[model samples]
Target chain A: MEFFINRSYFLNKITNVSHAISPNSPNPSYSGILIFLHPDMIHLTAQDSTMAIVTEIHPGELNQLRIESTGHMIVDAKYLIEIIRHMGGKNIHVMTVGDNMIQVSDENSKFNLFTLELERFALPDIKRPENEIKISLKNIRTTVDQIAYATSEKDARTMLMGVNFRSDGKRIITAATDSYRMALNYIDGEFSQNFNVTVPVRALQEAARIFKNDDDIIQIFVNKRKIQFVSDRTLIQSTLYDGTFPDIAAVIPKNFKSMMELDASMIIPVIERGILFKDDGVAELRMNLSEKGIQIYSGASTIGNADQQVYEVFYQGEELRMAVNGEYLLQAIKALKTLGKVRIDFTGVITPFKVSDPENKDMTMLVVPMRSSY
Target chain B: MEFFINRSYFLNKITNVSHAISPNSPNPSYSGILIFLHPDMIHLTAQDSTMAIVTEIHPGELNQLRIESTGHMIVDAKYLIEIIRHMGGKNIHVMTVGDNMIQVSDENSKFNLFTLELERFALPDIKRPENEIKISLKNIRTTVDQIAYATSEKDARTMLMGVNFRSDGKRIITAATDSYRMALNYIDGEFSQNFNVTVPVRALQEAARIFKNDDDIIQIFVNKRKIQFVSDRTLIQSTLYDGTFPDIAAVIPKNFKSMMELDASMIIPVIERGILFKDDGVAELRMNLSEKGIQIYSGASTIGNADQQVYEVFYQGEELRMAVNGEYLLQAIKALKTLGKVRIDFTGVITPFKVSDPENKDMTMLVVPMRSSY
Candidate 1:
């Protein structure tokens, strides 16, 4: 392929796709980026069997593109990235010289890199799937941001490693849990058919990064084995984990006798303070309510302990003392945007506790309490 | 011990000494900070055998300190730092109760931490050495900053892991090298006696961190096994390496046939661009000089290559081609201030290259060329 592209534009496009290229790919071709120069645009594609990313750059601006020929080649992603980084300018000249060599040069420096035949690379099937879901980019991103962190990273239990996306015609629900703490986000959306699928947390994260325009709609094609997220000029395809996700909704408590309402930001600092004393592999949060205020305390045996500044809150039922993971509580509180208050629901010492923004009832975070000896 | 101190003051003092506390100390006492509350001031000390730092805070500031008693104890450094960080206020109340328990509390919360007995912790002896050398803090910091990066971190070659500080009654010289490259800095100072000692790089780094006031004089007490640096309210003691430092002055080239001058900042970017291609371990500097101007071309095989924008230079040689470690060149250039011009002296391909800022002749960096096949 013979083409001249803007150095910055080419660098930006290459970087977007290079994140999917693993250095230790089992397949040598996967370690390279597939570069295709068509009549109008240059397409860069990289994948590591799990997540694939493709970005197309138009060569219309600044007379950035001069295509004399159309061809395809897989060039070493790492080397090409470094070359473009050092080239340093708006415009760069790239062309195919020998049968298996790509030449990238600027005014002062030139590099001739060996390339693999395009036929050797495993290109994913790009045909649109039969079952497609259209959703607003902002809604999907917000849902993912709110719940993705709760997914388990360890694959010992393969199902917990993915976030469950459930839709039932009227509403779309996203739930993630690692058995200890679960996050559920409910958003308004319409689905013609009920669907339940588990997408790996990493795939969701990559999709979130590639989908930047909030106003644009993201088209998701889901099948039995693969899921594809498409935006304006970018497409990310990932293989779904073939495992049954646990019923996270069943674990969320539906009733509570004691409820306290306090500001999320104010409560977050208290939880963070409690985390300071967490050592010996355990983090505990102790909450006590009195006529003065709500007091939060956290302590670890081997490390030190912390007591947080109390905030005035309205409490009902008997005064309670519950212990839970400080980190989980902190993460949940940080996700809440409106600083007004969070309603904390407690159901005795052994039951899971629920925390939700009082202003928004659609989002809920549940954390299972630690077995404290006290 | 009971006292109330400003949170910001205490935090800053603790942070300065926290770097000396070893996270993986075999002795638990080493992981804790030694607190000594005297009549007039409170002192915090932490040591890990390799290096020890002591900082003091005085009472009577913003009604923050209210001393009730004077005592000493050792509290966990990590936990204390985190507690203070999360405590969130200008003032913090700290007190010791019973034998080995410390309490740090604020307006709405209290944290009671278990502290180690002061007798169990080892505090380095800070007695003034008979053959101590006093140097201007500003001079020492400048010298250390210039040469410390060259010191080897690996203890396999113990001597190379320390910077050699040599004194000759009138001038103090500091030299550090990792065999491949060496940095030497000389500062004019009056010393009562001639001395030569190899101080560990860690000690130099600690000294640089604690010695903030340039006009303040830092007294250096050097014994057979330890080197002590003392400022007004801080004392940093470090163990000296027990190996002979090589005579690095012999490696510096005495004369040169070719020289080129260019701005340090201008050349730094060029080296940064060249470093992107430095993964293959070789950096090539192809210099072409004529009446027109001077240009530098550096490239690495694994990273990309870069051609630097030409700069007007006073050159006194034919076209020169040499390959040196890009890191060495970058470090030397960064050491130069806004008086940005750097002078490069070349002897031959086999000899070491010397780089220095024309404005400051006291500092010089020498880098050995790597044999390149290209």
Candidate 2:
């Protein structure tokens, strides 16, 4: 393979594809990036067993890309990126020097990197699925960020480690639950057909990173085995989990014993301080509401105690007290801070409570209360 | 104890004192900060046996410091700082609420922190030594930064973990070494009495952090057992290590077979990239200097090889080749990058080479060449 390209432009492509490269991948082929140089374009591919990322660079887009020969080489991803990034020159020259070595050089530095044989490289099979759904990057990113945090980090329940995306020809609903809490987001979109798939939370986060602007629309192609998020120059494909997600929509209660509205800016800092006094192993916090306002308190036998009061909140229904996981509530409140104000509805001491933005009705966050010996 | 102070100002003082606190201290008294409130000023102190930092806040310095009642309290350093820093109000009100509890409150939050009994608190003894020497903060800080990196991290030779500061009533010489490499710095300062002390590198680092401006002069109070760095509002006292530093000045050879000069900006980046191909367990780099230029190269059997050449250099030495630890050379070169150009003197392939700024004769860095199979 021989090519001369702008150092910075090539470095950006390597970094985008490196997102999927796992250093500890057992297969030697998976540890390097496969660079394919065609007559008009260059494609960089990197993948682990479960996910793959491919980025393409065309000659017309960047006038600096000058192709000398059409060939392919799989170079160690880590070393390749480091050499390219640390080089001082504006352009880099890459050419095959020996049977299994390629020379990457700039004005001052030259690196001879060993390349993996093409016969051993495990190239990912990428195909555009027949069923494709188009959605704005802004809407999809919001949906993923709102619900992905609630996914289970533990592998006990493999399905819970992913966020469930289900569409019914009219609206797309996403839900994530780690048993203790659940986050759900609903968005209106036109769908080609009905589909439900659980994509790994980590994969969704990586795909969300490709959304740089609200104006760029992304096309997501899905099948029974894999789902791919396709952008203008990049594509991220992830495999699906093989279990059914729990039916959690039935649990969103319609009635509550008490509800309160709070300014997100006013309450987030108070909870952040109050949680510092939480018990050593448990983030248990007690919140009380009355006609005056809301009060939150937490105490650890060895670490002292903290109390914070917000007197500007608007409360209705009956005065209530509930024990909750402070970290969960804090995260939900922080995520909703962009909405300015949020409303929280509580049923009883033992039931789950719901929090939502008063201005937006599509996003809902639910948390189960912990038992307190008050 | 009851007092109200500006939250931001108090937080800054707490943070400064917290640098000396160790969380896993065996003595409970050393884990908390002792706050002493006198009629004129308030002093905050935190110590971990070996090092102590005391900062004083006077009423006039910060007009927000209002002494309602004069008393003292010992609170957990970590918790106290967190609560004070997270509070939203401009001014924080602190008052004793119970026998061993103090209520630290702002307009929105209240924290009842458990304080250690004053009797158990190990108040650091900070008495200015009789022998006092004044030095610019800039000079001392520069001396520490230049030599501290060469100090031994291993405890096998306890004295090598400290930097030796010796003065002959006219000039102060600082030297630090871990056997393989040594860094020496010389600065002129007037002294009332001749003194030689080896202070722990860790302690010196903490003391150096207090030097914010070049114009500020710091007083060093030294005695047989302890050394203290005093500024206007803060004082850092550390116990002197009980051992004698080696006389390394005799080891710096004045004779050299070859010498070369290179631009710091040009060669530092080359070495940084060449070291990427270093051996797995060793940062071994090979350098060749001749009439052509300076060429550096390194290789690992499994990670490939890299070569970097610096053409813009003035050489006065015969053809020479040597192998040295890349990381050590890189660090010394990086530290001297501020000096535009650096001169390197090589005695032989196996002898210790020296690196220094051609303009500044006071600072010198020497590294031993490693044995390598060509």
Candidate 3:
């Protein structure tokens, strides 16, 4: 392979692809980035055990590329990125030398890196049909943010570590749960077919990051064994798990004994202060609602006890009190901060409760209360 | 004990004193901050096994303190800081309620924290004499920055972990070394006594952080067992090490066979880039100096090799080459970056070399060469 390209432009491409390459992979070739030089563009591929990222860089007004010969090589991802990032030159010259080595040089520095054989690097085949669905980047990003945090980080159950995506020709519903709490987001769109799939939360997060600076919409194709996202110059593919997601509709509470409406900005600070003694989110906090006002309090016998009151709250029905995870409540409230006010419903002390944004009615968060001695 | 003070002003005092308290201390009382409420001011003290920091907050223009009674109590430093940091009120009210507990409340929140008995909290007695030397805060801060990085972190040689401060009734000299490299700084000041003491590098770092916004001059008192620093509203005391510091005069070379002068801005980037393949500073790089110019290069058999050259250099001697730690050379060069052009002297291939700032004659850094197989 032989090529001359802009130094900074090459660095940007390698950094994005390096995120998918795991440094601890058992196979040495999995840790290398596959580089293929063509007459018009250069293609790069990096992968881990279950995911692969491929991107192409073409000659444009801002990017300079000149290809002398067409060839391919696999270089170590970590070393290549480090060398390119620190080289102090505007243009870089790259050419394959003898004895399985490549020469990379700028104006003042030269690096000769050992490369692996092309036959050792293998990428799984992915099918990209022409009938793939096009979804707005904003909708996909919102779905990931609204549901990814609820996925389980504990590896006891592999099914809970993914977010379920379901479409019924008119609307798309995404839900995530780790048995204690569930987050659901509803996005309305047009589609030709109905489907349901569970994607790993990490894959969704990577897709969201890649779309942060892209165009308005992208194409998504889902199969029985894999899923792919196609943009202008990049394609991301990930393997899907074979399991059924839990039924979220049946678990959501239908009615509540009491409901309160208040601005999210008022109670956030109280909860933040009350959790200082919450023992790193392991301790439970009691939330009290009554004719007097709203109060949140937690205590540790050896450390301290904190009690805080919210000044204004609109209430109806009977007063109720329940113990909930302090950290989960804070996250649920902060997610609805964009809306002016939020509504919280209580069914019982041991039953699940719901928090909803008044303006964004398509989204709701359900949190299960913890049993408390108080 | 009872008092009402400004929340922000109270937080600043505890934050400064908390630096001396270690979270992993075996003694429970040592992890707590001592609070003594007086008629005129509130004094706070925190300490570990080797150092103690005591600071006072008075009723000044910016700070408002109202004391109802004079008493003392010790509370966990971590919990107190967290409560005060998140409270949403201008003035905080603190009072002892009952049963070894104190109630801290603002307008919206209240906290009851358990406290340790007054008799269990012990602070070592430090001596302060009438005859003491005064040093500028700027001088102390600069000295800490220049020498602290060279202190040894290994526990095998406890004496090398402290920086030696020596005085001759007119100037104070500070030096630190880890057996491989040494850094020395000389501060000229008016003094009335001569003394030498080795203080832990951690203590100096804490003192520098405390004086970041204090007055210009502070008094320093040294004795057989401890050293004390006194300002208008604070006093810092630290224990002295028993062993003597290493003699730096014997290691610094007096004559050199080769010398080179170059702008520090010209070579910093080259070294920074060359260290990319240096395996986190374990690998050594070769520096070639001659009438031709200056060049630095390093290589790993399995990875790659990097070679870079300096743009302009003024040399005086025969051609020579030596291997040295890349990280140490980079640090020594960066220390003199503010003085513009720097002069470097080499005695031989394996002998110690010196990097000095031409504008600042009182500071010098010496680094020893490593024996390489190249």
Candidate 4:
């Protein structure tokens, strides 16, 4: 394709689309980015088979965009990005050099990169025919961001590695769990039809990056095997998980024997310091409740132990001692970053404890307590 | 040992000392930092067997440093640093909790770290006698910085991996080479004794870090087997390279057939962009001189080539063309960062070429030209 466009605008859009290309795709062409130059707009697409991202560039938005020739080609994503990154000057021209070769040039440097056969590259069939759920990009991002961390990256049960999206014509719930911990978030959205789809956590994370703006409206379209998230100029389609997500209400404890409301400012740093004295590989911090407050400690045989007393907590019921992975606790606390107070509910020692923000009832985190000797 | 000191001050001094603690040290105690609480001051030492660093913490610098028990203890460097880093509030107290146990506590957190046996830790014997080369830390750092990049990290020729320092009671010369290229820098300093010593590149780099101030005086003491770089509050001694360094003056061309004076700002980015289109593995950039300025190009078989015209270069003599690794050229340019203009001198097509800053006559670079198939 032959096109002359603003160097910076073209570079940013290309970079965002290039992230979808899998680094180690067996099919060489699948690791390439498809660039299509139309009369009105430029279309860029990259897919790793599982997740695909497409960004549209309108010629009017750029400093100078002129389509000398209209065509399509698939080029190596990494090589194209590198060439543009180093090619200096304010304005750059990208055009077809020869058969299956593209030249990107500025004032100082002209870089010619060989392209893969366009016909060999198979892009995912991504489309949004009719939307089942219509949600603001801001709400979608918040729901995904709060629960994405709880999803397991490399679980044998593939369903646990994805974020579950469940809608019932009115309210939409997104939940992610890895057996050890679970995070659930609720978003108010209008859904015309009932839908349940599990999008891979990585795909959601990558797709959210495209929705950097808050005012963008996103339409969610679901089929039997794929789900498409389409904004104004960006569309991302991800393969759906075949298996069902774990029921969140079933795992959460119905009744808690004791509960502690802790200040976010007080508990975060205490656990941070206590976690420093944690054992290798497994970071376990024990929360011991006394009449005074909560005494948190991390123990080891050779590295000694760290014990800190947290003052700002309202504890009731009998004295309790529970242990959980320090990293899990820190993540949950950080995920609910804007919360003024964090409420932690404990049910016995081995039972899972739930952490939630008092201000935001929509977000909840359940962490399975580790087996403690003390 | 027991002492109460400012948390940040202790952290900074310990972190500096911990750099000398090499991981997987054969002697377990060697991996631990020895904290000695003397009656007047605190001493910290860490040794990797090859290199040892000793830093003194004067009592006057701390808010309150009292030695209740004047003794020494060896504690794991990484663990001790981590504990102090997270311990909240200021004015921390470090004391021997029990036998072979150290307790560091602040207002919020109390960390107990188990210590190695004090008797087993053996520190390096480093001392400075009457007369030696005493150079300003700034000058030493400048000389090392200019030539240090030329040293090979894993050269079979061991001496090529170290920076050679030579003095003739007038000017101190520092040179490093890896057979492919060489960098030499001269510093004007008065030396009482004529000496020559080759210090390992890693040691010079580590020693340079301890000299954070330009005014700090660096005293160089050399024995047959060890070279000690003693700065204020910090003493770092490293084993000497037993091999002889190559003569840098011998490789530098005495006469030149053609020369080009290139602007640092203009030439650096042009070569950077040209190098992006370089051939696989080795980056070779050809410098072609025509009646019009200088043309730099980097080529590849399938990826095409990048050719850029630089107009700010002043050319002389016959039209000459030579090839050199782009990475080597970039490193020499970056190391002499203060120079506004860089001059390139060439003797022939395949002979060694020199790049020197026109403003700084003390620094010189020698690059062996590649056999160009131009």
Candidate 5:
């Protein structure tokens, strides 16, 4: 097989598929990308048992192309991508040297690599599910960004590394928690079924990257053990997590005694300046709400103490004090950046506080407060 | 003692002296910046055993000041600088809280730190030498920038960690080498005496930073064991290196059979793009000069091979091939960034090659060629 492709164009196409290539996988075929050259098209495919990605190059993208025969070869993803990335000119000439070796070259550079036999490579089954849901890639990106960061990345409980997607026939709710804080979003759309599937956060992140435009339509196919996302002629299939997520109603705090409503812009900077000892291990800020205003205090072992008064806060009920991680609160606040005002509800010093953006009422952030020492 | 200074103004003044305050210094006193709150002014001082730096914030710079008593306190340099950097208001209040503690506060932030008493802090004895050389900081910076990077940073041969300074009552010759490559600069200027002193590369780099302007006149006082640089109301004293520098003439190649002159800008990019296998341990580029043009070749075990033609060279050399480290050549080219065209003189395959800019005749760089295996 022989074909010609633009260097940069080939690099972009290979980069997406190469993400699924785990270099140290026990299965040698999983460590490479399948380069399939057809008479009229060329594409690359890679898989890491649990997930698989495929990307194609259309007919008119390359400068020139000639295929001696339709064939496929598994080439090391890293070396192939690196060669094309650093190739001299725009056009690249790729050809099959032998049954187990391929040569890729340009005008002044050439690379030959031993490839795995085509029979040994396994591409994940990506047939459309019984009931596929049509969703905008943009909406998925927003929901993923809002909830994925709260997932437990290093937790040995593998299921916590994913975001729980629960649909009750009409509305779909997405949530993520690391046992410390929970971020939940109520997406305004209907899904196919009432399935509660825990999709890995990494898969959601990769899907977000694949779907560049917010309005682009993407087809999501779900099964008992796998989910496939198809968009713009590319397919990303990941395995479904095999554990159950905690009940959202039980995890979210409901009642609060004292509530403080403040301008979102005013509170962000106040927290940034007030929490001066951020470089130390865990960043904590104390919030004391009075009838007049709210007082924020933070101190570090060596870097002094800070006390800032924010008169913009509207307080109700008796005086209340709560201490929470400053960075987590900042992130939860930034997630609602488009909103004009933010409201924080505190029940007691030892209780979890709930934060909500007045403008975006569909989403709420629950922050677990640390035991106060102040 | 009490004083009020602008936050940004205080940050900049403290930044210079804080460099000498090595936080992990063996002596606790060296980790703090001594704040000498005089009746009319306040100055900050910091020192590691080998080096000391002092910077002044004069009386005119502050908005207001009321010095109740004249005393000194050694406050932690890092914490003090961090507090002033993130201070809320324009003016910061600095005062002595007690016998061994200091307080720095503003409208929204307050910092208190335990300090080393004035009696325990050991200040280096700084005095003007009998004879000192008056030189433009700009010229010294230029010379230091060109040669300092060539020295051995962690080599057991401590003298190689510094640049050699030699004078003949008229010209100061500076050179540095890491036993592989050598950088030499001959600066034409008058000096107080014909002395040879090896100044640590770190000291030269710090002095270059202290003297911001090239036209600023700096007095360099040299003694048997220490070198004192007084510039712009700041004094930086560093212990001079106590050993002999290798004879540069014996190290530089004296004979060559081939020479090539090329535009430095053209050569830099050609080398960068032609040798992309840089992530591997050692980068070797083979330069083959033919009657037509020069062809550069580079290859790695996994990352393929690269060959590019460079037609922008003026060559009268025979058919010769030499392998050299690409990064070393790139660094040498960068050192001559201001020059338009660069000339490289080569002797043989094993001999070192000398590179010089046609415009800047004062500096010369010699790069050792690696022995070829292919």
Candidate 6:
């Protein structure tokens, strides 16, 4: 495209879209960022088949723009980004000199890069989808933060790599699990249609980062194959996984024989101390409740052992003994927002237990106990 | 060993020595730091065969020490560093509990770790050589800063991976090269015996970091296989590379055909500007000197080019044209400590060139030119 703009303004716009460009894409054209120059603004688009990002830069007071011609071209994302960042100048002039080369220059430095054919680049069509849902930006970001980490990273189980979003008429629930532990976040919202969809955790993380500055509502368009999150100046589209998500709601335990309330920080250090030794894949938590307080002891035989931790808790049940993965317990403790106390439910030695912050009832974490061979 | 000391005090001492411990050592005990607690002070030592560091922590200020036990043990570096950092307490009590287990605890947390046998660790039997040389710490640190970056990192040529120290009757010169470029620094010092030795670059870096507090004088004990740098509280021992270092003095060009004097900052931006291009390994400098001022032009083919950077310079010869790697030129420019003009001497298009600040002759940089097919 034939355009002249400030170096930093153009650099920032290209960087935002460049995150979606992959160097080793099967389609050669997908390795470049599509640039469209109009009369008043320039648009940049980058996609790697799975995720796409589109950003528009409007000429402002600092970014004065002059458009001599309107054209479209795809330039290599990695080289172009590096060239612009290292080109030392405040104002840079960019123009399409010929059919294949783009010229970028300033007072002391200039760069001419070969451009790929625009027709070969895969720019996703942005027509309005049939199924559209509107949600609050804050709620989406918070829900993604809470559940995204629990999603399985391995591709052996395709469906487990995504977080499932289920919306009834009034409230929306988000759950993620790798078949080991599950994280659930519930938010209040209004939905015109009842729908359930699985969105990839990587895409959700990118959406959260792009939506950080946007305070307005985000409109989501979902079809059978793709989902698009659109704001005012930014649009992020991601492909949907073609697998059925496991029914994790049924796996969450609802009944407990005994429960205890203890400070989250107090229990976190105790678990960390205990993780030093036990090599059998299980960390035993022996809890003794007396009139004074609750004492939690965990030990590992092969590495060493740890003791000397006491936490104040409210418990009326008999002394309970359970063994679970220390990493799972640490994750559950970290998910609690408030540091006051965490209410942990114990269903038997083998059943799944739930951990939740006493002040907030909307979030719950469940961890399946490891079978102790000892 | 039994001791009660501040947690931060022990953590700092361990961290200083832990850099020398290598987890992939042939002997498993070498992966741990040796701890020797006597009645007066506790000494910690770690070695990876290439470099070794020893630090001592004395008793008294914070807590009363019960010297009921005196022994030596080797603890894993990674686990000990992590535990000491995460254990949140001012005073931590450490004692040898059983055969190979040590108990580390405070009021809130306790950790027991399995220690390796002290007999399995290889503590280098290093003694201070009879005939040794001593140099000011300030001079040694300055010499290291000047030449360490030019040391070759490739292990194929072991001798190039070290900085060669040449001491005559009155002066000590340090030089390093990676076959492409070389840096040499000459400093005035008193030596009892003239000798030349090569020390590993990594050991020099560690010595520089450890002696950052500017000790008065550092004693250097050099043997056939080892070199020891001794200070008041620290002893840094490193193995010497056996291969003979190349004679770098022969590569330095003693005479020049053309010379030019210009400000160091002027050439810095030009080199920075030339780095924007994908190709064009060497930045060409064409100087056209007439009755008017000098004009310097630098350009890259794939990237655009720049022209007409006029600077007032006194040229000693006819119009000169030369090209050098932009990175090498930038390095030479940065090594100039003074803010005034720098003198650059060129022999020919392919021969080596030298650059030095006009005020000081102690520091000089020699760069070999990259052959250009064109």
Deviating ranges (above 4 Å) for candidate 2 = A61-63, A117-120, A247-250, B61-63, B117-120
Residue range A33-147, candidate 1, lDDT tens digits: 9989888878889988788898887767654778878988988888788777866556878888778778887765566677865766888776666677877878778767788
C-alpha positional error of residue A22 in candidate 2 after TM-score superposition, expressed in Å: 2.2
Clashing pairs in 6: A277-A300, A278-A300
Per-prediction TM-score to the true structure, in the order listed? 0.91, 0.95, 0.95, 0.95, 0.90, 0.89
- Second chain TM-score, each model: 0.89, 0.95, 0.95, 0.94, 0.92, 0.88
List, in order, the clash count of every candidate structure. 3, 0, 0, 0, 1, 2
Clashing pairs in 5: A138-A214
Q: How far is candidate 1 from the true structure (C-alpha RMSD, Å)?
A: 3.2
lDDT of 3: 0.81
User: Which tens-of-lDDT digit does each residue in B87-206 have in candidate 6?
Assistant: 777878889888998888988677888898788887766677655777778877876777777788786888888888877567788888887788888876666888788888777777
lDDT per residue for candidate 3 within B1-374, as digits (tens), equals 89998899888889889998887998888888999988888989999988899998888767778888888899888989988998889989988878688889998789989997667678656557444777787777876787777778885778788888888556788888887788888886556778778888877777778875534787888776787877768788888877888768557889899999888887777787777766554757888899678888887778888888775898898678899888888888876546388888999888888988889888888888888765
DockQ of 6: 0.43
DockQ of all candidate complexes: 0.46, 0.74, 0.80, 0.68, 0.37, 0.43
* Full ranking by DockQ: 3, 2, 4, 1, 6, 5
Best by DockQ: 3
Q: What TM-score does candidate 2 reach?
A: 0.95
TM-scores of the first chain across all predictions?
Answer: 0.92, 0.95, 0.94, 0.93, 0.90, 0.90
- How displaced is residue B282 in candidate 6, in Å? 9.5
On the 0 to 100 scale, the lDDT of residue B16 in model 2 is: 85
Lowest lDDT 10-residue stretch of candidate 2 chain A: A331-340
Q: In candidate 3, residue B254 scores what lDDT?
A: 92
- Model 1: clashing residue pairs? A7-A90, B277-B303, B277-B304
Worst 10 residues of 4 chain A by lDDT: A123-132
Give the top-scoring candidate (lDDT).
2
Deviation in angstroms for A321 in model 2?
Answer: 1.3
